[model samples]
Target: MVDQAELELFRDNVRRFLEEEAQPHYEQWEKDGIVPKSFYRKMGENGLLCVDQPEEYGGIGAPFEFSVVVLEEAARMGFMALASNLSVHSDIAAPYILHLGSEEQKQFYLPRMASGECIGAIGMTEPGAGSDLQGIRSRADADGQGGYVVNGGKTFITNGQNAGVVVAAIKTDPAAGAKGTTLFLLDTDQDGFSRGRNLEKIGQHAADTSELFFKDMKVGADKVLGRLGGGFGHLIDELPRERLVLAAMAVAHARGALERTVAYVQERKAFGQSIASFQNTRFTLARLKSDIEVHQAYVNECSGKYQRGEMDVPTAAMIKYATTELEGRVVDQCLQLFGGYGYMSEYPISRDFVDARIQRIYGGTSEIMLEVIARSVLGR
Candidate 1:
């Protein structure tokens, strides 16, 4: 459960932080293609980095709702790229350590991560694999020194360039398929670990997305995450929460675009009249608002389920697919309301539109989400 008053207070703080610290510099970062690593440390100082980990690790250890508030505020401010980076560190990577890491691993990394001194990245997708985790070609064979020598590369890795540590997925036995998959936490400064240049994209320029290569990178056996051959299971266990937050982000993004469009339509004139006075404009925005409200409620329900530990794979897939698809549609419709200005890079809607595109691709593709949903309905 969440305290409504506290949540609102936190939302105010997050919004103020962004307006003062982030928004003014966001466009510049977009041009730079990466947020400064020092900015992350600043976020730690503000206690805005990771809000939900245990206090011993320098986190507030607040309820998951506090994190939800952070996510919503980020998206509301149109800071999607930065929000995604923080979520990856706080929600995605840290949980693996909290749940599966040895005491030494937890002690060494969690505090640094919580303080934003060490950014975290997860390596699961390879050149040949995206949704199909079982198809990854990265390999890790045992070294007689009680460690594994990792070989192969990961592409489209979020936070790759800036991450101090990475939880890499590798195949311990290629012939064993998904059962052969293993995860190892490696310090990126280690010998033979390299990062490729930041990949250019249509959007999300501020977020560091890159290709990571491991050339016989050595990781001690103690660095293995979870049980041997249980990497797939660990990933599966975490997918629902990941997908759920993505859904929430989608809804928040759409709401941001829609709100901006609402204000734009009222002020922008067309054919000697305000566009808001036109029937078509009213109907378009009305439909979009209605759709957003309905979807927002569903996402809230899903979030509640997640906090209760009742979120399931199929439901998570459904929300991910539905909300992301809805985000695309809502943003497109909202952008259309801006007419030519929407197409201009100067307009915030343009960024929102492009950023929404990747929501469907990562986390899980729309097609993959459908497959997961269909399996639940048709019996897998």
Candidate 2:
């Protein structure tokens, strides 16, 4: 279990880091449609990235709670772009290397990733496949040199545009179905690797998501992560962490949005009185606050279980689905409370609304989460 003192320290460190490093440039990055690579390097310098990675890899090797702190603080500042981006690199991508990469691969990549010298991304979603990992059509043919020639495209890849390396999923034997799926550490600078335009998203406008194409992209056998034909197993193993991280972000986001709305209602006047004086406003805020507290407690409990390696896929999926959907609803209600100003881009709630939209879609969709939960309940 995470102690209050440690959690407090982590909260302080992340809050300071954001105030000093991230917040100052957030708006400009949003306008530019991407954050600079230097920003990520700065985070590494501050030991802000990959807190849970091993100490040998230049990581702090802190518990999962540290990561939760970072995500919560980032979300509180309305920097979901930064939170989501780092979650992909540190929480999602790094584990693949740590658990599956060879010793040489770890030594070569882990330090660079820890120091933000190399930005990492995972390519699992294809144009034809979103939650259906089994439907990916990217192929990798044996090159007879113990390597493979990769060819296909991936879309909606987080960190796609700026990623120095991508853990790409491809089928080495089409007849093998999910068993044929393999993972490769494809260098973005490789000859046949290319990225499409940075997707203009409805929310999280500052995040750098894009389409990736690999046309005859050559990757070494050494770059293959984990055992051949075991890609599905590896993904399944790590998905609990991924889903937990998403749940943490969701709870934090709803809390932050609700807090902002409360402050607004207390100060903003309506009908010759503070909006907070209205029974409607009082009931709405009361309900949101209670809901947020309930979710926060649940998520915190899950975070503890996750640190102890006791969390399961079904529980993670449940929280991820519930919290993200709650975040979307809370943010929308908060925006409505903001009246006309909420619709204006000048209000942080406007961006918060946009940024919160993708939470239910990514990190496994709400529908997918429900399926996982139902299967568990039904003893499947």
Q: Pick the candidate with the highest lDDT.
A: 2
What is candidate 1's CA lDDT for residue 370?
98
Superposed model 1: Cα runs more than 4 Å off: none
Tens digits of per-residue lDDT for model 1 on 1-380? 77889988998998898888898999998898888898888888888766888888888988777876777777867888887887788778888888889888999999899888999988888878998887899998989888899999999988988999998888998999879998889799999899999999888888899999999888889889888988899999989878888888888889999899999999999899998999989999899888889989998888789889999999999999999999999889888989999999999999999988999999889999999999999998
Off by over 4 Å in 2: none
Weakest lDDT window of 10 consecutive positions for candidate 2: 1-10
How many pairs of residues in model 1 come into backbone collision? 0
Quantify all predictions' global Cα lDDT against the true fold. Answer: 0.88, 0.89
Instruction: Provide C-alpha RMSD values for all models, in order.
Output: 1.0, 1.1
Q: Could you tell me the TM-score of candidate 2? A: 0.98
What's the C-alpha lDDT at position 320 in model 2?
94
